[model samples]
Target: MKASALWPMIIILTLIITACSNNDEASEEVDEEDLEETTEITAFMPEHDEMNFEENSFTKLMEDEYNIDFEFETTSWDGTAANERRQISLASGDYPDVYYLIPWVDQFSPSDLIRYGKQGVLLPLNDLIEEHAPNLQAVLDEDEEFRAMATAPDGNIYGVPQLVECFHCTWGNKMWLNTSWLDELDLETPETHEEFKETLMAFRDEDPNGNGEQDEIPLSGSTMTQKESIIPFLMNGFIYDDLETRLLIEDGKVDFAANKEEWRDGLEYIRSLYDEGLIDPGAFTQNADAYMQLGNEEPNILGAAPAVHIQLFTDNDNQYDFDALAPLEGPNAAYSSYTHPIEQGATFALTNKASSAAQIKSIQVLDYMFTEEGSLRAFFGEEGEGWKKPEEGDVAINEDVEPIYVDIPEGEDETLRNDNWAASAQYYHPVEFRDGIVQVEDIYTEEGFERRLQEATYLYEDQEPEDVFPYWGVWYGEDVQDEIAELETNILDNVDQSAVRFITGDLSLEDDWDDYIAGLESLGVERYVEINQDAYDKYLENVE
Candidate 1:
C-alpha cells in the first residue's frame, strides 16, 4: 500500500511540474508576439533616384528596431512639382500621417508651418519632442540659431528642421576663375577690384584658350539665383551685397545696401565692363542652362563664372581647370555673401492625421537620426555597403579632425543601390561630424570635390562683415509677414532690373540713379527695413 501510494503521489507531482513549465513557455511566446507588433505610419516624401524607401536598408532597420511599418507617398524631386503636390494634398485634406521632406528638394517654409500649425493640420511637436526626443532636445538646447529657426513665433515647434552644418555652403556666392587660362596667360589670381577688371580685359583681348577664335566670354553668370549672379561677387567689393535680402545692419540698425552711393559706384564699374564688352550681355538675361553652355563649350570659352561650385557651370571634364577667386577688395569693403548652414525650412513634420502611437514611433525614428551611429546609418546607409570606417592613412576633410567614415564609391554599372535615404534623412549633421568624413589626398579628383570646396571656402571665410544680419533665424509675425514678403519682392525686383538696365546702358547711371532710389522708396523700401528690423530684434530675443 505504501509503495503504490508513493508511486501515485510522485506521478501527480511530476504532472503538476510539467504543466507549470508548459504554462511558462506559453507566456513567453505571447510576450514575443507582443514585441513583434508594429505601428503603421504613412509618410509623404520626395522620390530620389538613389533610394527606394520600400527596399532601403535604413528603412528596413528602422522598421525592425522600432516595430514600425512605413508607407510612403512620394513625388519626383522636381522642386516645383513636388511643392505643388504637397500643397495639393494639404488643400484637398488628403495629406499623409507624416511629411518627411528633403530640404533642398522641398519642405514647409516658416510661413507654411505657422499657417498649418494654427490650422491644426500640422500637429504641435513641442510635447512629443520633449517627451520622446532627447537627442533632438539636446541639439535645440545647445544651438541657439537652430532653436530660433525651429520655433515659431507662438513658441511651438510644428516640425523638426534639418541641421546640416555644411561649411562650403555658407559662402554661396563665389567667383570660379579658369586657373588653367590664368596659368596659360601667366597672370596671377586677382586680389583687388582693379586687378579683377584687368584680368577680365586680358581674357577678352588675349587668346587664353588658344583656339584663336576671339570667342572667349571674359565673365559670365546666370539669372537663376543670387549665387549665379555676376553682380553680388563684384558688388560686394563696393557694398555688402547680401544678394537676396539687400539688407545691411550697421550699429544694430537695419538699412538697404542697394540704395547707398557705393552701390551706384559698383553699377558704374559694371557698366564700364559692359561697354568694353568684357561683361557678357547674356549674363544679365541667360538662365542656368544657357549660362552653363558658355562654360561647357569646346576648348572652354569661359574665363570666369559666378557659382557656388565649378560643377554647377561646367561638367567634370572642365571642373578641374577652374579655381575659386577670393573676394575682391574695393575702396569701401571686401565682403562675401554668407548664409548660415542651418537651412530655414522644417524637413520632418507630423500631421494631425497620424495616430498617437504612430506619432510617438515616428518621432522616435527621427530622434535616432540625431545620434552619430543612427545619423551615419540613416544618411550614408548600412556599414560596408554605403560607407565604412576610415582605414589607415585616410585623411579627413578637415585636417584637424580625426577621420570617422569613408564612403564606398558606387560601381560604374550600378545606377542606384536603393541603400540609403540620401538627403531626406539629414536631421542633424554638425560641423564635427561633417568634417570627420575621410577624403582622398588628391583634392582635384571627383571623389575629393568636397575637399576642394573646403579649401575654396577657407579663402572666403571671415570675409563677411562682422555685424552681418542673421537672416535664417528671423521669424516675422503673421501680421507683417505678407506685407514684408510683398515689399521684398517689389524692392528686390526693382533693384535687380534697374541695376541691369544701368549696366547695359538702357538707363544712364547719371540720369537714372535718382529714379532708381526713388523707385525703391515707392516700393516701400523703408517700410521693408522697418519690419525686418523689428523681426531681427525679436529674433535676438528668441535666440538669446
Candidate 2:
C-alpha cells in the first residue's frame, strides 16, 4: 500500500506485455485460437484532456490480459461539432475500429447506430458474446430489459451497455435555502407550496440583510442542466409535474410531459413569483460561470435557488452557505420525484471489421466494469494494493486522488494521473457498494443526509409513469422509433417555448391553455401513444 511498492507491480505487468503478450495461460496453452499477427484496434472517443490513456491501469491490465493494443481518436464533447466531424469521417471512409463514449444527439445518436449497423459498419455481438463473454451473457439474461434495449431493429446486438448502480444518482429537484438568511428572519424551512412562496417573497422584500441595500436575489440558476435549470423541474410542485425538458413515457405515449395542463399551472406560479420580484430576474439570462460567481462570492447573495444538492450551490464547507429544503407539498397535497433509468450513457462499441476475438473481448471488458471486482479496478485501480478497502460502515477517501480537484480553483483545469504508475484512478465500483471506501460524512453530514432521507423518503412513494404501463417502458423498433422521435421533439419544443412565454407573462395560461393542449394534439400525441403501445405489446409478447 505504500508508494514505493507500486513500481514492482508495474514492472511485472510490462514484462508480461513484452514477453507473452497479454495472457500467460493463453500464450502457453493456446495455438489454434491464437489471433493472427498485428491486430490493430483503433478507438474513437471524446476528449479526456487530463487522462493519459497509455499509463491508465485499466488499459495496462487489459492490454496485458488480451495482448491487444488500442489506438484512440478523440474529440471534445460538442455534439453539433462532433456530428459534423463524424459525417466527414463517414464520407472519407477512414473510421476507427471502435467508438467509445459517443453521446446522444437528436439526429446523430439512435439513428447513427441503425444506419451504421445496416451499412455493415458494426458487428452483431450476440453470438460473439455467447461464445466469448460469459459474464456479459449473465447480465443480459438476468436483465431482460437491458437486453431488449441493447438489441437493434433487425434484432441484432451491435453495442455494449453502460450500467451503474447508483440509486441516489437520480438527483431529485430540490430547493436549498440559506439557513443564515432564515435565522436572521427566524423562519423555519418551508414545508408546503404556500410557505415556499412567502419565504422567497420575504427574501426579496424584507431586505433580510440589514445593510439597507436590496441586492438579495431570490431563486437563481442557469440552463446548465435540467435539475439545475431555474424554471423547469422546480416548478413541478405547482403544476402537472411538467418540466420544460422532462422526457417521459406518459399514457403509453412518448410525448413530452411539458405539454400537459400541469405545465401551464406551473408556469402560472412562476409568472406570479417573477411578477412579485421573488424569482431572480437574472437567472434566465446569466451564464453558468457568472451564476456560480454569485454563489461562491465571499458572502454569497443567492437565496432559495433550485439545485440538485447543496454542493452544486456551494462547497461542502458552510463558508459560502446554503441549506436543503424538502420538495414542496403542493395544493393537490402531492409530492413526487421524477427520474430516468439508472444507467446514464453509452461507453463503447466494436466494429464489424474487427476479429471475433475483439468483438467478444470488448463485451467482456465492459462486463468487468460492472462487477465489484472489475469496476473497482476499472475506476479505482488495483484492489489489494492501489486502494485500501475501507472497514465496514466506514467511508474513506484516497488521500492520493480526491474526486473533486481541490488542487485547482473553480474553472481551472483538472489534471488526471495514471493509477498504474502514479497513485490512483478516479472512478470505481457501484457507488452504493462504495460505502466503506467513500464517505457521505465528508460530503453530507449525518444530520444533512438524515434530513434528505426524510424528505425524499416520503416523496419516493410516487412511482414512474412508465411503470404503470409497464409494456411502454422498453425499447422500440425502427418504425416506432421514427414516429416517437418526431412526436417527442415537436411536443417538447412547443411546450418549452410556450412555457417560458407564459411564465414571463408574454403569454397567459388563462388565454393559452386550451390552445396549447390543441397544439399538442396537432403535433400527434395519439400516434405517439400508439407507437408506444405497439412496442410495449411486442416487448411483453417476447417475455411471455
Candidate 3:
C-alpha cells in the first residue's frame, strides 16, 4: 500500500508543477506580445546613407517608449530628387502617414503646407499640438516668431517646423578676409568700402601669397547659394542687399532694394572692383567645389571669400588664416544681410492618410523631440555614447552660461554609426540649449569651430537695417502665392543677371540701369512688392 500510494502521489505532484510552469510560460508570452503591440505609422523621410533606421537606437527607444512603429518610405537625400519624390507621392495619392523631413535636404514650404492643408492632403496640426504636444505648444506660446511661422494666415497649424535657433545663421552673408594676407602686406583691417577696395588692390598687386605668378583670387565666392555670392557682402556697403530676396523693409513697408538708387551705386562700386580685376570673374559662375579649390590652393591664393562659414570654402589647415570682416562702411550705411535663425520650412507633417491613433502617436513622438532630453537623444543618440555631461573645466559656447553637455567625437573614417536620426529629428534646438553645450576654449581648434562662428557672427550682429524685411515668417494667400512665385522667379532672375552684366561691363549701369528697371517692372516688380507687403502685414498682425 505504501510503495504504490507514494508513486501515484509523486506523479500527481510532478504533473501539477509542470502545468503551473506551462501557465507561467503562456503568461510571459502574452505579456511580450502586448509589449510588442505598437501603432504603425508610415513616414516619408529623406534617406541619409550614414543612418540605418532599423538599427538606430533612437528609433528603438521611440518604438519602445511611445509604443509606435515607423514604416519608412525614404527618398534620396538629394534636394531635387527628394522634393520630386515627395510631390510624386502626393500627386499619386500614395503619400505616407507622416513626413519627417531634414531641413537642409528637403522639406515642405509654407505654400506646400497651405496647398496641402487646403486640399485635405495634410491634416491641420492645431488640434494635435493642442491635445498631444505640450513641449511644442510651450515653444509656440513662448516664441511669437515661431508661432507666426508655424501658423498659416487661415489660423491653422498645418505642420511642425524644425525650430533650430542657429545664431551664426542669422548673419549668413559674411566676408572672410585672409588676415594672413593682410599681415603679409602690412595692411590694416578695412573699415570702409574704399578701404576694402584698397585692401583688395593690395591683395591683387602686392603678391600677398609671395607667389611671383600673381595667382591670388583677391575676392571670390561661389554661385551655389546667395549666401556664397560676393555681391551681398560688397553691395551691403551701399544698400541693404539681402542677396536672395533683394527686398527691404522701410517703415514697415515692403520695398525692392534692386530698384533703389543706392542699389545702382552698389553695382557701380562692384563694377569698379570687376574693372580693376579685384573681383574674381569665376566667383559669379563657379560652384562650391571650384571656389573651395581656389581657397585650398597650395600657396593659399584666396585673399578673401564670402560665405556663411569659412569651413564651406577652406579646410581646417587654412581656416585659421582667415578672419571675419565686419560690414564695410559705405557712403550710405553699413549693413549685414540677416537671415532668420529659424529655418524656413516645416520638417514634420501628418498626412490625412494617418489613422487617428497614428496621428496621436506621431505628434507625441514629435513632441518628444521638442524636449531637451528627447531632443539630445533623437539628434545626438544616447548619453555617454553620443554625448556626455560636461566635465569640471568645460566651457560653454556662450561663456556666461554653464556647460551642460559635451559631444563624443566620432572617428574620421566612420561614416555610418546607425545610432541616431542625424538632422531629420532636429525639431527644437533653442539658443540656450545650443549655447549650453561645452566647447573648447581655443576658438582656433577644430573642436571650437562653432565658437569661432559665434565670435564671427558677433561682428555682423545688429548691422542689418533698422527695419529688415521679415521674409521667413510671412505667408502668402493661395490666390497670390502662385502669382508671387512666378513674378519672384522672373524678377529675381532678371535682377541677378542684370546685376552680373552691369558688374562685368556687359551692360553699362548708366544706360542699362533704367532698362533693367523697366524689365523688372514688366516682370511685375511693383506687384511683387505689393503682394509681399500684404503678406508682411499679415505676418506682423500674427506676431503682434
Worst 10 residues of 2 by lDDT: 401-410
Ordered by TM-score, highest first, the candidates read: 1, 3, 2
Candidate 1: Cα lDDT at 363: 90
lDDT of 3 by residue, 309-338 (tens): 998998848888999999998998898998
What TM-score would every model get versus the actual structure?
A: 0.92, 0.77, 0.92
Q: Which pairs of residues clash in candidate 3, taking residues 3 or more apart in a chain or in different chains?
A: none
Clashes of each: 0, 3, 0
Off by over 4 Å in 1: 1-36
Stretches of candidate 2 exceeding 4 Å from the true structure: 1-32, 35-38, 76-87, 102-108, 238-260, 315-320, 341-345, 383-386, 396-415, 420-431, 434-437, 440-476, 480-483, 535-544
**What's the CA RMSD of model 3 in angstroms?**
14.5
Q: Which residue pairs in model 1 clash with each other? A: none
Q: For residue 219, what is the lDDT in candidate 3?
A: 91
After TM-score superposition, the amount by which residue 213's alpha carbon in candidate 2 deviates from its true location, in angstroms, is: 1.7
| CA lDDT scores, all candidates in order | 0.86, 0.57, 0.85
| Ten contiguous residues with the weakest lDDT in model 3 | 21-30
Candidate 3 regions off by >4 Å? 1-37
Per-residue lDDT tens digits for candidate 2, residues 211-230, read 67788887887665556666
Question: Judged by lDDT against the true structure, how good is candidate 1?
Answer: 0.86
Error of 3 at 452 (Å): 0.9
